[model samples]
Target: MGKTTRDRLLQTLASAFELPEDVVLDLTRITITGNTQFLMENHRGILAYDPEKISLRTDQGETVITGRNLKIDSLFASEIMITGSINGIQFIRSRG
Candidate 1:
Protein backbone atom coordinates (compact mmCIF):
# COMPACT_ATOMS: atom_id res chain seq x y z
CA MET A 1 0.00 0.00 0.00
CA GLY A 2 1.01 3.62 -0.50
CA LYS A 3 2.03 6.00 2.27
CA THR A 4 -1.02 8.20 1.90
CA THR A 5 -3.34 5.23 2.11
CA ARG A 6 -1.70 4.02 5.28
CA ASP A 7 -1.84 7.52 6.72
CA ARG A 8 -5.52 7.83 6.01
CA LEU A 9 -6.17 4.47 7.59
CA LEU A 10 -4.30 5.55 10.67
CA GLN A 11 -6.29 8.76 10.81
CA THR A 12 -9.51 6.81 10.64
CA LEU A 13 -8.33 4.49 13.38
CA ALA A 14 -7.37 7.47 15.48
CA SER A 15 -10.84 8.92 15.14
CA ALA A 16 -12.47 5.61 15.94
CA PHE A 17 -10.31 5.08 18.99
CA GLU A 18 -10.64 8.67 20.17
CA LEU A 19 -6.87 8.93 20.35
CA PRO A 20 -4.39 11.42 19.03
CA GLU A 21 -3.03 10.77 15.57
CA ASP A 22 0.50 10.60 16.91
CA VAL A 23 -0.52 7.92 19.37
CA VAL A 24 -2.29 5.89 16.73
CA LEU A 25 0.53 6.30 14.26
CA ASP A 26 3.19 5.35 16.80
CA LEU A 27 4.85 8.73 16.60
CA THR A 28 7.40 9.70 19.19
CA ARG A 29 6.24 11.22 22.46
CA ILE A 30 8.73 13.12 24.62
CA THR A 31 8.58 14.30 28.18
CA ILE A 32 11.20 16.30 30.02
CA THR A 33 11.67 16.83 33.71
CA GLY A 34 13.57 19.96 34.51
CA ASN A 35 17.12 19.65 33.16
CA THR A 36 17.73 16.23 34.63
CA GLN A 37 15.68 13.63 32.88
CA PHE A 38 13.83 12.81 29.68
CA LEU A 39 11.31 10.16 28.76
CA MET A 40 10.49 9.15 25.24
CA GLU A 41 8.01 6.66 23.84
CA ASN A 42 7.31 5.13 20.42
CA HIS A 43 10.83 5.79 19.22
CA ARG A 44 12.38 3.90 16.35
CA GLY A 45 15.89 3.61 17.72
CA ILE A 46 18.88 5.43 19.02
CA LEU A 47 20.98 6.83 16.21
CA ALA A 48 23.75 8.15 18.41
CA TYR A 49 24.56 8.25 22.09
CA ASP A 50 27.17 9.79 24.30
CA PRO A 51 27.65 11.75 27.48
CA GLU A 52 27.06 15.00 25.65
CA LYS A 53 24.65 14.06 22.91
CA ILE A 54 21.96 11.59 21.95
CA SER A 55 20.04 11.19 18.74
CA LEU A 56 17.01 9.09 17.95
CA ARG A 57 14.87 8.33 14.93
CA THR A 58 11.12 8.75 15.16
CA ASP A 59 8.20 8.45 12.80
CA GLN A 60 8.03 12.21 12.37
CA GLY A 61 11.76 12.97 12.25
CA GLU A 62 15.07 12.72 13.99
CA THR A 63 15.29 13.84 17.59
CA VAL A 64 18.59 15.18 18.84
CA ILE A 65 19.29 15.81 22.47
CA THR A 66 22.31 17.55 23.90
CA GLY A 67 23.30 17.50 27.49
CA ARG A 68 25.94 16.70 30.10
CA ASN A 69 26.55 13.33 31.75
CA LEU A 70 23.85 11.90 29.57
CA LYS A 71 23.00 8.26 30.09
CA ILE A 72 20.28 5.87 29.10
CA ASP A 73 18.96 4.90 32.48
CA SER A 74 16.31 2.64 31.04
CA LEU A 75 15.56 1.27 27.61
CA PHE A 76 12.79 -0.88 26.17
CA ALA A 77 11.34 -1.73 22.80
CA SER A 78 8.87 1.18 22.88
CA GLU A 79 10.27 3.50 25.50
CA ILE A 80 13.53 5.04 26.70
CA MET A 81 14.47 7.01 29.77
CA ILE A 82 17.49 9.31 29.77
CA THR A 83 19.02 11.11 32.67
CA GLY A 84 21.42 14.02 32.47
CA SER A 85 21.82 17.73 32.67
CA ILE A 86 19.89 18.39 29.50
CA ASN A 87 20.94 21.44 27.51
CA GLY A 88 18.72 21.35 24.48
CA ILE A 89 16.39 19.24 22.41
CA GLN A 90 15.86 19.51 18.67
CA PHE A 91 13.66 17.77 16.15
CA ILE A 92 14.81 17.63 12.53
CA ARG A 93 12.04 17.07 10.05
CA SER A 94 12.39 13.95 8.00
CA ARG A 95 13.08 14.71 4.36
CA GLY A 96 10.66 13.28 1.89
Candidate 2:
Protein backbone atom coordinates (compact mmCIF):
# COMPACT_ATOMS: atom_id res chain seq x y z
CA MET A 1 0.00 0.00 0.00
CA GLY A 2 1.08 3.55 -0.74
CA LYS A 3 1.38 6.35 1.72
CA THR A 4 -1.70 8.05 0.30
CA THR A 5 -3.78 4.95 0.65
CA ARG A 6 -2.56 4.26 4.15
CA ASP A 7 -3.25 7.81 5.15
CA ARG A 8 -6.77 7.60 3.80
CA LEU A 9 -7.44 4.45 5.74
CA LEU A 10 -6.13 6.00 8.91
CA GLN A 11 -8.31 9.02 8.42
CA THR A 12 -11.34 6.84 7.94
CA LEU A 13 -10.59 4.88 11.09
CA ALA A 14 -10.01 8.06 13.04
CA SER A 15 -13.34 9.42 11.95
CA ALA A 16 -15.19 6.24 12.70
CA PHE A 17 -13.67 5.88 16.11
CA GLU A 18 -13.61 9.58 16.89
CA LEU A 19 -9.98 9.33 17.78
CA PRO A 20 -7.16 11.81 17.41
CA GLU A 21 -5.38 11.71 14.10
CA ASP A 22 -1.97 12.04 15.66
CA VAL A 23 -2.43 8.83 17.64
CA VAL A 24 -3.79 7.01 14.65
CA LEU A 25 -0.97 8.10 12.37
CA ASP A 26 1.77 8.24 14.95
CA LEU A 27 2.24 11.88 14.17
CA THR A 28 4.30 14.28 16.19
CA ARG A 29 2.74 16.08 19.13
CA ILE A 30 4.43 19.02 20.78
CA THR A 31 3.65 20.86 23.96
CA ILE A 32 5.33 24.01 25.13
CA THR A 33 5.19 25.20 28.68
CA GLY A 34 5.72 28.94 28.58
CA ASN A 35 9.32 29.49 27.42
CA THR A 36 10.92 27.19 29.92
CA GLN A 37 10.22 23.71 28.60
CA PHE A 38 9.15 21.61 25.64
CA LEU A 39 7.61 18.20 25.30
CA MET A 40 7.21 16.10 22.20
CA GLU A 41 5.57 12.78 21.43
CA ASN A 42 6.15 10.38 18.57
CA HIS A 43 9.45 11.86 17.47
CA ARG A 44 11.61 9.68 15.26
CA GLY A 45 14.94 11.04 16.42
CA ILE A 46 17.05 14.09 16.72
CA LEU A 47 18.36 15.28 13.41
CA ALA A 48 20.47 18.07 14.81
CA TYR A 49 20.94 19.63 18.20
CA ASP A 50 22.64 22.59 19.74
CA PRO A 51 22.09 25.12 22.47
CA GLU A 52 20.16 27.41 20.20
CA LYS A 53 18.57 25.03 17.69
CA ILE A 54 17.18 21.50 17.68
CA SER A 55 15.93 19.57 14.71
CA LEU A 56 13.87 16.43 15.05
CA ARG A 57 12.66 13.86 12.58
CA THR A 58 9.05 12.76 12.80
CA ASP A 59 6.48 10.72 10.97
CA GLN A 60 5.11 13.74 9.17
CA GLY A 61 8.45 15.41 8.50
CA GLU A 62 10.79 17.62 10.45
CA THR A 63 10.40 19.68 13.57
CA VAL A 64 12.72 22.58 14.26
CA ILE A 65 12.94 24.00 17.72
CA THR A 66 14.61 27.33 18.33
CA GLY A 67 15.48 28.63 21.72
CA ARG A 68 18.19 29.45 24.18
CA ASN A 69 20.02 27.07 26.49
CA LEU A 70 18.19 24.15 25.01
CA LYS A 71 18.88 20.78 26.57
CA ILE A 72 17.21 17.43 26.43
CA ASP A 73 16.00 16.68 29.91
CA SER A 74 14.51 13.26 29.17
CA LEU A 75 14.26 10.92 26.24
CA PHE A 76 12.02 7.92 25.74
CA ALA A 77 11.34 5.66 22.81
CA SER A 78 8.87 8.07 21.22
CA GLU A 79 8.87 10.98 23.61
CA ILE A 80 11.20 13.79 24.60
CA MET A 81 11.45 16.58 27.06
CA ILE A 82 13.60 19.67 26.77
CA THR A 83 14.42 22.40 29.16
CA GLY A 84 15.22 25.81 27.75
CA SER A 85 14.01 29.25 26.90
CA ILE A 86 11.97 28.30 23.89
CA ASN A 87 11.50 31.08 21.37
CA GLY A 88 9.89 29.37 18.42
CA ILE A 89 8.80 26.06 16.96
CA GLN A 90 8.51 25.28 13.27
CA PHE A 91 7.39 22.30 11.25
CA ILE A 92 8.44 21.31 7.75
CA ARG A 93 6.42 18.49 6.29
CA SER A 94 8.24 16.22 3.87
CA ARG A 95 7.05 15.57 0.36
CA GLY A 96 5.61 12.12 0.22
TM-score for all predictions? 0.85, 0.92
Best by TM-score: 2
Among all windows of ten consecutive residues in candidate 1, which has the lowest summed lDDT?
A: 21-30
Q: For model 2, what is the error of residue 55's alpha carbon versus the real structure, in angstroms, after optimal superposition?
A: 0.2
Query: What C-alpha lDDT, on a 0 to 100 scale, does residue 40 get in candidate 2?
Result: 95
Model 2 TM-score (2 dp): 0.92
Model 1 Cα lDDT, one tens digit per residue, 1-96: 498699888899899989997667877788899999999999999999999999998887899999899999999998999998999999999885
- Name the Cα RMSD for model 2: 1.3
- Each model's lDDT comes to 0.90, 0.91
Estimate the lDDT of model 2.
Answer: 0.91
TM-score of 1: 0.85
